[model samples]
Target chain A: MAIAEQLQEFCGERRRDLVRFANLQLRDEALAEDVVQETLLAALQGSDAFSGRASVKTWLYSILKHKIVDTLRSRRREVPLSGMSNADDEDEGFETLFDRRGFWATEHKPHRWADPEDSLEQQQFWQVFELCLDRLPARTARVFMMRELLGLETAEICQELAMAMTNCWVILHRARMGLRLCLEETWFTR
Target chain B: MMNCKEATQLMSQELDRPLTWRERLALRLHNLMCSGCHQYRQQMAFLRRALRSRSGGD
Candidate 1:
């Protein structure tokens, strides 16, 4: 099949995942749809650049990442402070995970997740992972995805989000703790 | 002694940047006696691997 036809088919298959990824980063449903649309259009126009080395999904994701970053940079000046304030501003919710003396609370203690590596091969595990990820606060999810999925550095994330380095670390720590607990509860223990 | 809270923070920070020797030493000491924290660190590492596997061709 020709590249154009292949990419059209790819668009139908991967569009939902791409939009979810963009929505996580942008936190705007409409903007996420627009970016994904633009990504597919760009891929179609530059179909010659569709090197066979990368899978179609991966290639589309790379394109989507650029589009999301561009949208973010363009909107940086006008982003309402309120939008960025709620996610990392307070530590009160996370504080309950520890006790007065800083020990893990009995109910919140981390248990051994047996054979976690095996879950990678299971489709159900990814479904649970997505659900847990969706439960995170929007800004927190964005920061975690930017760092872990997009492979951005701490300094870069801080700069992009206009957040303090310490604040960035706090958000990441919260994300990791929240995700670990969610996975343990919903997947590992079950 | 570093408590579980501090130790887990160090483990998460380790992913973003190199811990200072003092911080590393403190975490190392805490993990030795803290099974919960040790498990937490391992889970965080596992999470990272899982995410990278999904974001292939990056």
Candidate 2:
């Protein structure tokens, strides 16, 4: 196949992953959709020069991430966070994430939990997982999703968010805690 | 104060279960001395399991 044809085919297969990555970065499905479209176009246009230096997916992810960061930085312009919780965050069970109780409380174990990593392969499991994720504070939500859902490294997310190591760690912590609290209330009770 | 950020993060992992080596050590160290963190971890564990089931559930 021609290089463009081959690159086109390769990207088609991984389009969902690309779109998902962009979605997490941009947070708006429409904007993510636009980013994917632009990324695919760039990949297709540049295909003739593609020397296979890296796998197509990696290259595509690189393009998508840069495009996303550039777009976000230009558009955001330091607007203070809107404090908008998800309209669908109807699952109020995770509200404790916002509460300030015994957070440092060095007392009891609360309880012990079994592993759900085994069940994580299923789409439904991920759906609710994504739902809870959508509830996190936006920056925290973005950093956490990029690392956990999309498998970006801590350093990469830190760079993308322009956060310090400690700041990134703290965001990940809060994101995890919020998701944990949310997931426990929504998923574990059964 | 561990702050909501740190507490939330540590508590979140504990909820997810089978704590990492780092978390286990932290919990062990804190729980050994501080009764509060111990109970906190315990409650977090319970809350986590309960939430997990609900997640895979309807």
Candidate 3:
């Protein structure tokens, strides 16, 4: 097969996973599919850029990542997180667990999670984690994924989302707390 | 004395930026005395590491 034909076949096989991964980041199914389709096209057309340095999957992901960012930048104007009006309150319930002295209230202490490394290897654990992530409010989920998944810094998240630094931290803290509690209820406790 | 709230905030902050010696000392002392805060700290680290290693999850 020609290089173009081979690359097309490779990317086609991975299209579902690529689109799902994009949905995980972009959180919009339509946009995710759009980027994945664009990624396949870019990968097909930019064969010269492949350079034989990384796996085809890695190269495709890099293109998808940039495409997602570009999509985010274009969509940011409409998203308008500017007023800080949506001050996240999902954390309030968790706050009550910590007392005035900042100690855990009698029943609210975090239980020891089972061997997390073991859990990481379990496919179901990722499903639970992904669901928990989806449960987070949109802005908070975006920040948590950017920081944890994309490995973006706090500064970049603030710039991309047009959020204040302090607000970003607050959202992150709440996001973590929410995920823990969600996992406990859905997977850990069960 | 860093309360659990303050200690947890510092713990989350540590992920974003380097902590000062004083802040580090404060967190260490707090964790030494507070199992809840210690568990909270560990959970945060575990979550971050797990997500990072898994490439933000599959």
Model 3: colliding residue pairs: none
The digit string of per-residue lDDT tens for model 1 on A118-171 reads: 999898998999889888876788789889888789999898887899989988
Question: Any idea what lDDT model 3 has?
Answer: 0.78
DockQ of each: 0.68, 0.15, 0.55
- DockQ versus reference, model 1: 0.68
Instruction: Tell me the number of clashing residue pairs for each predicted model.
Output: 0, 38, 0
Which 10 successive residues of model 1 chain B have the least lDDT summed? B49-58
> lDDT of each prediction vs. the true structure?
0.84, 0.58, 0.78
Residue-wise C-alpha lDDT for candidate 1, range B29-53, written one tens digit per residue: 8898989898888999999999987
How would you order the candidates by lDDT, starting with the best? 1, 3, 2
TM-score for all models, in order of appearance: 0.86, 0.56, 0.85
Clashing pairs in 1: none
Name the better of 2 and 3 by DockQ.
3
lDDT of 3 by residue, A7-51 (tens): 676566657767777798787899889898888888888988788
TM-score of chain B of 1: 0.93
By descending DockQ, how would the candidates be arranged?
1, 3, 2
Sequence-dependent TM-score of model 3: 0.85
Evaluating just chain A, the predictions reach TM-scores of 0.82, 0.63, 0.82
